[model samples]
Target chain A: MLINHPLLGPRDAAEFTCFGDASLLLRPDPGPNGEPDQAAMDAFHDYLHLRDNPAGTHQELWYHEQGDRSWLVVTRDTINHSIIKVELARNVKARNLKTREGAG
Target chain B: MRYSVFSILNQALRGNTGWKPVWREPEPRPAYDIIIVGGGGHGLATAYYLSNVYGITNVAVLEKGYLGSGNIGRNTTIIRSNYLLDGNEPFYEMSLKLWEGLEQDFNYNAMVSQRGVLNLYHSDGQRDAYARRGNAMILNGADAELIDQDRVRAMYPFLDFDNGRFPIQGGLLQRRGGSVRHDGVAWGYARGADSRGVDIIQHCEVQGFIMEGGTCVGVETSRGPIRANRVGVAAAGSSSRVMEQAGMRLPIESHVLQAFVSEGLKPIIPGVITYGAGHFYISQSDKGGLVFGGDIDGYNSYAQRGNLPILEHVCEGGMALMPAIGKARMVRSWGGIMDMSMDGSPIIDRTPIDGLYLNAGWCYGGFKATPASGYCFAHLLATGEPHDNAAAYRLDRFRSGAVIDEKGSGAQPNLH
Candidate 1:
C-alpha cells in the first residue's frame, strides 16, 4: 500500500531474500538471451529466509501476498531488507523453497 | 460470518430432502413465458433469479430427470476464484461473492465449507506459476497466500514429509476456496423458485425444439409439447445432444467425472487440498471419512459409471501425496457426465436461435460456480445479453479456436 513499498508484510507482494549465493544469476534463465556482462556481483548479498534457504551458501527469506500458496522467489538484502529481485516460486524453485536453519 | 459456503449449502440440502419427484413427464402448457430444461442447480437458480430479480414469474423449469441428480449430485464440490486468465478469474470471483451470501439470500443453508484450497507445486517453475496465481488471487480480491514445505508441515502436520518422486516444493493457498453440499444447492434454488409461483416440471425430458420459423417457440418433451417464448437448455450431460436436435452443433464433449469417499479415517484432512502437480484432492467430511476426487476419464463418455483407470489414478495420487491414507479403504465412488467444453471453461451465452438459451459446459468446476453460473445465466436469459464474463465463453470461441483453458498444461481437467 505504500508508494515506495518499503515495509514488506504478509499482505504485500512476494519478498525473497538471497544472502551471498549468486549462482542463480548465472544459471541461464533467459538462456542465451540473458547475456549478463559475464562479470556481475557474486559477492555475499545478505538475504532473509525463515528457515531453509534452498542453496548451501545463500541464506534467504521469501514473502508473497500475490503468490500461489507457495512463496514466490525473491532476492533481497538480509541486513537492510532491500529487495533486489522477485521471481515466481516456479522460476527459482529447487526442491522445497526452504528448510529449517540447523545447528548454525 | 457464522457459516461458510459449504456450511450454508449443506443446511439447504437437509431442509429440502425429497421435495421433488424422482421422475415425471411435463404437461404441455399453452404458453409458458420461460422454459428451462434440466432442474439441476443452474436451472433452478435461473428460475429463482428470473422471478425474484427480473419479475418474470411465468417461468417453467422442465427436467428430464430428478433435480440435482445430474452434474449437481455427481460433482466434487471445490470452489475458488484463483484464475490466471481474464475470462475465468472475474466470473469465478463473482460466483464466490454469491456463494458468500447464499444462506441469507435463500433463507436456506447450503453448508459451504470455506476450508480453503491449496494447489501444490513440485518444481520451481510450478512454484513461479503459483506465485503468479497467488498475486492474481489477491488482485482479484481473493484470499490467497504462498507457503513452503515447513509452513505446510506446520499447517498439515499429519502429512508425510519424506522426499519422494515429487517432493513438496510449495503451494498456492486460496483461503476463500472450499466445498459445498452439491444436492442442497439444487433443491434450495428449486424450492425457493417454486415458492415464487414458478412451475416446477419434473420427469419432463426435452425431446425436441418446437421452433416457429427461426425462433424457439416451445419444447417438445416426453410428457407433451409446451409452448414457451424463452427456452433455456440447462441439461448437463445431454446439453450437446439437445443442442444438436435443435439444429446446432456445439463444441461440447460429454465426459464423465467421478468422486470418491473412503470409510471414515478419523479426521485426517482438515480442509480441501488440490495438488497442482498431481491429479488428486482430498478433504475430510464431517463424518470423519475422506471425501475426495480426481480428473475424469480422459475419453468422452456418456455412461453414468466410470472405468477403473480414473479411480486407480486418483487413489494413486492420493497415496503418493499422503502416505498415511493408504490404509483408508475406498468406501464408495460415483460418476456424473459433464458437458466438458473445448476449453475447460463454461459456455453460458444465448444461442444463435432467437429465444433459445444455452447454459452448459461447466466441466468439473460447476459446483463452485453454481451460484455465479445461475446469476450470469439468468442475466443472459432476462436481458438477452451476455453477462460481463460470459462474453469470453461465446459458443463461437470453439470455432474461432480461442480457448480460455486455465490448466495451461492443456491437459484440461482430465490432466488435473
Candidate 2:
C-alpha cells in the first residue's frame, strides 16, 4: 500500500508504523471538577483501548519512521486497502478539538 | 455411533449406510441457559466442557458459518508451551496436557503428533533469551531442552549453515510440543458437545445483543432473537465488533496473519521449526506439504486476505534459513484475523454488562490455547469467577498495571 505522507509525499506502507484507529486522537477530557472521576477514567480507558475496527474506510494513525517522523492520519478502505486521504495527525487533532469546543 | 473396527465392519456389511452425522444440525432455540457465540474450536470446546464437566447442559453454540470455518481451520497447527512469562506458561502447559489426552476423551483421531518443536537461535542474545524461556518452561512443569549447534546440525543437515547474516548457533527444543489436526479438533468438540445435549446451531448470525436494564439478556440473531441467562462471546477476529453491540469497547484490534502451504513433496521436515532472527516458522504436514507463516500484515484489518509484501518477506526469511526449499511451489495461501490485544496476551473475564462474558485477544496464539481457553472460560461462566490459571487475564489488567505482556511490546496492539 502506498501511503501519501503529509511531509514526505508518497511512501510505502512498510516505512510507517501502524497504531490502529484514529479515534485515539480524541482523548477524554478531565471531569467537571478538573480531576478524574470514575466516569472520566472509564471514558479515558475506552478512548485508549476500544476501537471501531471497521472493515472499510477506516481512519488510522501511521508514523513515518523512515521519512519525516510525522504521524499521519491515513484514511483507507481496509477491505481493498486503497488510500483515501492523508493528513498530519496534529492538524487533525487540532481541528477535531476546535470542532468539539465550538459544538460544546 | 462408536467408531471402532467392529462398527466399521458392520457398516461395511450394511453397505455403509448406517453411519450417522458426527454432529446434529440444530435450529436456534427460543432460550438457553448459556449461549456461546462463534462455534469455532474454542467456542465448541467451551460448550463441551460446560455440559460435561460443569453439568450445564442447556447451552447453545451459534455459528455464523459452518463449524471450523474460522481460524480453527486456518492456523499453522503448531502447539507448544515454551513460554517465559508466569502468566502465560502455566496456561499453555495446561493446554498442552489437555491436547495429550484430547483424542481419547473426545473419541476422535485428531492426529496429535508429538514430534517436537525447535526454535533456532541466530545470536548470543537470542540464545540467552531462549535459555531463560527454557528454564521458565521447566519451572512450569513443561519439558524444554537447550541444544547446541552440533545437535541441530546433526538432526537437520539441510539448513543453510554458511549463511553470514544469521549463523547456526543453537536452538531450544520442546519434546512434547507438536501439531494436531486443526479441523478435527473443532469437529471433535462439536460432536462431544452435541452428544451432551447442547444445541449446535449453524448459519445463525448474531447481529446484536438483547439488553434489558443494562444487562445482556440474549442475542438478536439473523434467524431470530434468542434468550439466554448468560452469553459468552468467543468470536476471534470479530470480538470488538461483536461486543460493540453491547455498548462495550475492547482493547483489541483485528489484523490479518497469513499462512502458506506448498505442494506435496517428500517429507523433509520432521517437526516444527522457527527462525529466531525473523518471524517465519515451518512444519511439514502429514500430506507432505510444507505449512508456514510469518508476522501479521501490520495494519488493522478485518479482511481474511493478505497482500504480497508479507508473502515476500516470509519467503525471504525461509530462504535465509533453508535455501534448499527455495524452488518449492507454494500452492495455497490464506489469512486469518487475529485479535491483537494491547499487551500481547488474552482477556477471558466478565464484562461490565452483568450477563455477558468475553474470551478474546488471542493475537496469534488462539489455536494453541483452544482446549485450556475453553476449560477456563467454561469455569468462569459456571462459577462467575476466573479460573486459577486464567486469573491474570482480567479486563482491567492494563489499567491496573498488571499487563501480562508476554512479548514486552507495551500497549501497541500492532507491535504485539
* TM-score of only chain B in every candidate structure: 0.91, 0.98
What lDDT tens digits, residue by residue, belong to model 2 across residues B73-143? Answer: 99999899998899999999999999999999988889999999999998899999999999999999999
What lDDT would candidate 2 get against the real structure? 0.91
Off by over 4 Å in 1: A1-104, B1-28, B408-416
| Pairs clashing within candidate 2 | none
lDDT of 1 by residue, A17-100 (tens): 112233332232222356533332111111110012121122222333343344444454322334455445455544333321
Misplaced by over 4 Å in model 2 are A4-10, A27-43, B410-416
Candidate 1: C-alpha lDDT: 0.70
In angstroms, the error of model 2 at A63 is 2.6
iRMS, all models: 24.6, 2.1
- C-alpha positional error of residue B410 in candidate 1 after TM-score superposition, expressed in Å: 6.9
What DockQ do you compute for every candidate structure? 0.01, 0.61
lDDT, candidate 1, B59-87, per-residue tens? 89987777777888887777788888878
Highest-scoring model, DockQ: 2
> What lDDT does candidate 1 reach at residue B80?
82
